[model samples]
Target chain A: MTHVITDACVDEKDASCMEECPVDCIYEGGSRMYIHPGECIDCGLCAEVCPNGAAVALRLLDPAAAAVHGPANDAFFTRVLPGRQAPLGSPGGASRLGPLDVDPS
Target chain B: MTTHHPAPHHPAAHHAAAHHPRAHHPAVVDAEACSAALDRGETLPWTWYADPAITALEQERIFRRSWSYVGRTDQVAQPGQFFTCEVGGVPIVVTRDRSGGLNALVNVCRHRGAQVVREDCGTRKSLQCFYHAWTYGLDGSLRGVPRGDREADFDTSQLGLRRASVDTWGPFVFVHLDPEPAPLTEMLGELPELLAAGGIDLERMRFHHRVYYTIEANWKIAVENYLECYHCPVAHPGLADVLDVSPDAYELEVRPTFATHHGVVRDIPREAGYPVQGPVVEGQYHLVWPSLKVNVNPGQPNLSFGPVHPAGPERTTGYLDYFFGDDVDEAWIKAMLAFDDQVGAEDTDLVESVQRGASSGGVERGRLLLGSEHTISAFQRFVLGRLRED
Candidate 1:
């Protein structure tokens, strides 16, 4: 299991997680930094460094919110990773990206 | 390497002229010509958003060939610390070498098309292809091949990861796919001076906040929204309260190659229960053309919103950086973040609405209400004129 930064990090942007990561798995974004699940050794350095307390270390055994991880990762990757010139929450979650000037209904 | 000459009447030129009543438009105009357009007050064409053909052309001429901001110097903090990003939609990797120097390479591996850096970011002693264990050094040198000796004639040097032209300006790390790209400073024209006014001391500043929003609006719309502050009074009540609102307070400062608007609005009524504190800079908004913003709030740290996906037409990603002078304490920083989030929410609402409305019928070119929102008019003219020309 890996540690993930959630939307809570958006306003927090506390980079303590970045400094604590021994492997430096955390990467900064526009408003928040993220821990790369692939590279995160799951050693939990991020959880220690986070200032606003926005990082979450995922454990598969903890069946509470495991189901939401996939969607959350998708949201973080698509919205936080690549970043659109547009706004992520506009249509809530419009997968289709029309032509720039084309006003999608 | 295929060298293609700039043919007579480049395709971009024809497309630029088609948008306006002009007979001809050059594919690539110099900084001076662009400045002249700004001087004459001629509205630039809107092809930066509408023309996919022109966008494709820019991918090669602008993004591929120019030094573009890829990430922060802090991204690759140590050897093998690497991250994947896209330049002109081409995925590339930014890594730290054993020598601690940063390098950018195409994420695609030589043996297989698999991405060298599967994760968005991480620290590794070496980048190994997940598909076949083909490895690369932190400095982008080819390091290993699982069992390629059977090939009989395998030159490892030739298989080194593809290198890109990478440079650093301030905290921003930029990469250029073109082997011989123009220097980053030259491409920035007069942007540095504008950023300086916002107290952009790169060394003094450290990474504080990062949030990415994937908007449905064309990247241009987001840029346009950012370039102007006309919507501040109505759309951003929280922000408008801090800056003095008036035509004189928020006038467009346009040079040949740049344009910016700064103003101040009275603080929002505390009774209104908005997130604001201390003496805020009275409506000082600086717009560094193309895609950058340096926002100042007197007592608060200067906030720079550099939209990385400047030309991502269909979608846009923006980088928001908040820089605090040493005088700022942790509590102040937390309060500032609260204020920032509130203002960001307002912007998100307006921009998302505009993205949705642009698609509705009867918006070919929305009428501009001058005086109050002249920044938008200025931005629209610049964009339309730039697009209209080749």
Candidate 2:
């Protein structure tokens, strides 16, 4: 299982969890942050030190989210994630997937 | 919980009790070298104390590479929350933009390099350059230029405000001077374990008290003073009464890269468990290399870090912050704030006095008693070693 930042990090994307993760698994996802499950060491350091509860470990085989997590993680590492092309919240832009008003700052 | 242990007498008690690597590694500084420095009354590593050359080197080598604590996440809690802060003297603005993600940008504007946000904090959709009216979104993308079409070869996207490397830990926000810094995780090795043991659940905590002080002492002096409990017995009367500081009560431990001194004040009676969730230690002080100090007091946790704005060899500015758990009540917060004020005021006076005396040049150096002031001696050794390192 790798950590995934939920919508809570959307606008208030404080990156403390990014700094806290030892494996450098966290990456900027436009408005929110994403943890590459493939690279994650599952140290739980990100969740433990997040000032805002924006981080959650995605139990990869969770039949529901697995479809998105795999593609997302791959795109994040390859630096070709579609989310990067346009700003989040822009329609033809980055997907507005993360939390909206949850403040991570 | 017992706070007292019989004081032990040993040759290198200060060396052992302090966080001195040299105590464990005598070869680092030869015995003859120690004798020569001591004979000249200049032994205890003056490089860490009196060296402009080292300070400049630190700004480039150490501060630039390290994850510097810029501000707290709570400062920018709303959709457009924004604040200006400095990390290693680099001005930065941390904003929660319309999109809701926090962005750390050099406070300097892309146009004319004027600072965007002038005040401490507020809500703004985009930061407009006060001088030329060039505006940038919270995410640091250039959103509005005064005249987009006029400038030849003008690429607004290319002219976006430079974003600093930013990361958050608990309620604190950290920024690196490096454009591409080492991940915060690797930089903060074993600190999470230490913070967790001390009961700092970053998610539930809130930014409570922020007190800034301009001290006339080297930043290292404040740091060195903070790492030890030797002065608590003499200087901090209120703190001394509450903390568990008796003979053999303090233990300084280091985890390869980080150094921590655990001193529990077990005898003090609790009012209502601590204000936050954590073990009942009076204080857990952790010092991460370069410039970060976490003082996890029983009721509140305070972090202090800043460049030693060396106006000269004698003057400095000290910036301090205190964070508390969310579950704490307002009354408790107000009381804690009062307590913090007193402690901070007292500390400012004490440190400033030390700076004045040191500047007088009357005392060249002083010896450390083996048992009482081990932490100070150890920290001095650590400072000296880091200064010596390329």
lDDT of 2 by residue, B1-390 (tens): 111111121222111112222122223344356445544434354333344554555455556557877777778878779888776556788898766787888888877878878988887655666666565767877755534544599887787788888888766778886778778888679888777777776666666545545555656666556656677667666666556666577666655555677767655454432243244345676777654666666655433322233333334554556556666667766665555455656666666566555434456556665455555555555555554466
lDDT of 1 by residue, A17-95 (tens): 6654555556655566655566565544355435565676665225656556434643533452342464333232111
TM-score of chain B of 2: 0.75
Candidate 1 docking classification: incorrect
Total backbone collisions for each predicted model: 42, 23
Which candidate ranks first by lDDT, i.e. highest?
2
Give me the runs in candidate 2 sitting further than 4 Å from their true place.
A1-105, B1-57, B266-279, B299-313, B329-340, B369-390
Provide the lowest-lDDT 10-residue window in model 2 chain B. Answer: B1-10
Give me the displacement of residue B285 in model 2, in angstroms: 1.8
lDDT of each residue in A1-105, candidate 2, tens digit only: 556666666667687766545445576655777666565555444654455766655552466665655545444444434535432322221222432332122
Q: Write the per-residue lDDT of candidate 1 for residues B34-90, one digit (tens) a residue.
A: 445545543233333444554565454444554666678778777667878888778
